[model samples]
Target: MTLEIVVHRPSVSGGGRRVTVGGVDFGLARGDGDLVEFLRRAGLDDADQLVSGDSPIIQWRGGRAHEYGAAGG
Candidate 1:
């Protein structure tokens, strides 16, 4: 199945990135750990595999992987 998960740009306040799966908002994630958990809770058992590299399942907007700091935004 193809899932469109978007990790939106980090806010200037540095709260965290907003995670959305298939247009539904899950929550904010500060790091990969939270991202993995959110994906798992969303019914993806292979969340780990999808969270790394250029999986094409995730659209990292306004930043790339490993970048979620407010100071950089």
Candidate 2:
């Protein structure tokens, strides 16, 4: 089965990010050190340096990045 992960980097919230995998929202905030650490253990990279124009980089079973970007206005 293929896993889908959505990484949201909202401009206003800083690093209060959200990652959704297979419709399950990982309501993980940067403030929650334990949760972030847990996700790190699960192979998620640190997202503190994200910006508005950044793309949602994804990693999969084959270890390749699926570069997804927002639609141009």
Candidate 3:
């Protein structure tokens, strides 16, 4: 089964992007580290690689990888 991971736009408050797996909300991630943990918990052992590189499994919305601009930005 393909995991539909979506990194939503960063929030204006804390600049944390919401992460969802297969349409399930995994909470907000402030950075790649938070995203990696969420992915690992979701059973993706290669979470590190997946979060680091450009992988189609992850559909980033609003912003690209690691581009969570400052809340003031």
Candidate 4:
């Protein structure tokens, strides 16, 4: 199964942007660096998998979703 990275822009309270992996909110991100850190902490290797356009869509197998990436499996 493919996972979708849903990003919520920073709110008016000055809270950093937030991202969710596979519908689960990971946490807030101040910028690209913070986003990457969150993704890594969530066990994602290639960040391209989170790209919805241009990037190749990864096909899912019978295991965890994050295991797949643009390279396909």
Candidate 5:
């Protein structure tokens, strides 16, 4: 299955990283494996990590959040 991961810029106030799968925002931690697993269970793959910055939001098409670099930095 195909999934879209929307990674937003990290915020100190909110102090959190939000992950969006298929248009659904799944609030998650930087290294929350459970979140990736949840996405996999929901029909994703690989799921290693997701990379993002405080620039324009990035949209990646893949199976898991790992191969994408979802780990908040």
Candidate 6:
């Protein structure tokens, strides 16, 4: 299983590269380690369960879809 990390930068006001995980949106200033830690804390490190077709536990929060688990795990 492989984890895909996508970095997005918007060309608009208040637009910047951010990492969203488990319904939480974090700025790039937070650092990569922080992002990884956030994912780990969200039970996303379980590669077995993630790759078993039960991945991307999705939940609606703040009018957006927050996905958990590994991508293509």
TM-score of each model, in listed order:
0.88, 0.38, 0.87, 0.58, 0.46, 0.30
lDDT of candidates 1 onward, in order: 0.85, 0.41, 0.86, 0.53, 0.48, 0.39
Identify the runs in model 6 with alpha carbons over 4 angstroms from their true place: 1-6, 10-16, 22-29, 46-73
Question: Tens-digit lDDT track for model 1 on 4-46?
Answer: 8899998789988999998889999999989999899889899
- Kindly list the per-residue Cα lDDT of model 2 for residues 1-73, writing each as its tens digit: 5445554453243534455555666764343353345345445565332222243443222212222222121
Where does candidate 3 stray beyond 4 Å? 70-72
Ten consecutive residues with minimal summed lDDT in candidate 1? Answer: 64-73
How many clashing pairs in candidate 5? 14
Report the Cα lDDT for residue 5, model 4: 60
Looking at model 2, the pairs that clash are none
- Candidate 4 global TM-score: 0.58
Candidate 6 lDDT score at position 68: 27
Candidate 4 local distance difference test against the native: 0.53
Off by over 4 Å in 1: 71-73
User: What is candidate 3's lDDT per residue for 17-67, written digit by digit as tens?
Assistant: 999998889888988999999999899999999988878889888766787
**Number of clashing residue pairs, candidate 6:** 0
> Tell me, what's the RMSD of every candidate?
1.5, 9.3, 1.7, 11.8, 8.1, 10.8
What digit string (tens of lDDT, one per residue) describes model 6 on residues 23-69?
36544413334444545654577534433343554222222222322
The worst-scoring run of ten residues by lDDT in candidate 5 lies at 49-58
Candidate 5 per-residue C-alpha lDDT over 10-34 given as tens digits, one digit per residue, 9 for 90 to 100: 4444444556777786775454564
Candidate 1 Cα lDDT to native:
0.85
Best by lDDT: 3
Clashing pairs in 3: none
Structure candidate 4, residue pairs in collision: none
- Arranged by lDDT with the best first, the candidates are 3, 1, 4, 5, 2, 6
Model 2 spans with C-alpha error above 4 angstroms: 29-73
lDDT of 5 at 9: 47
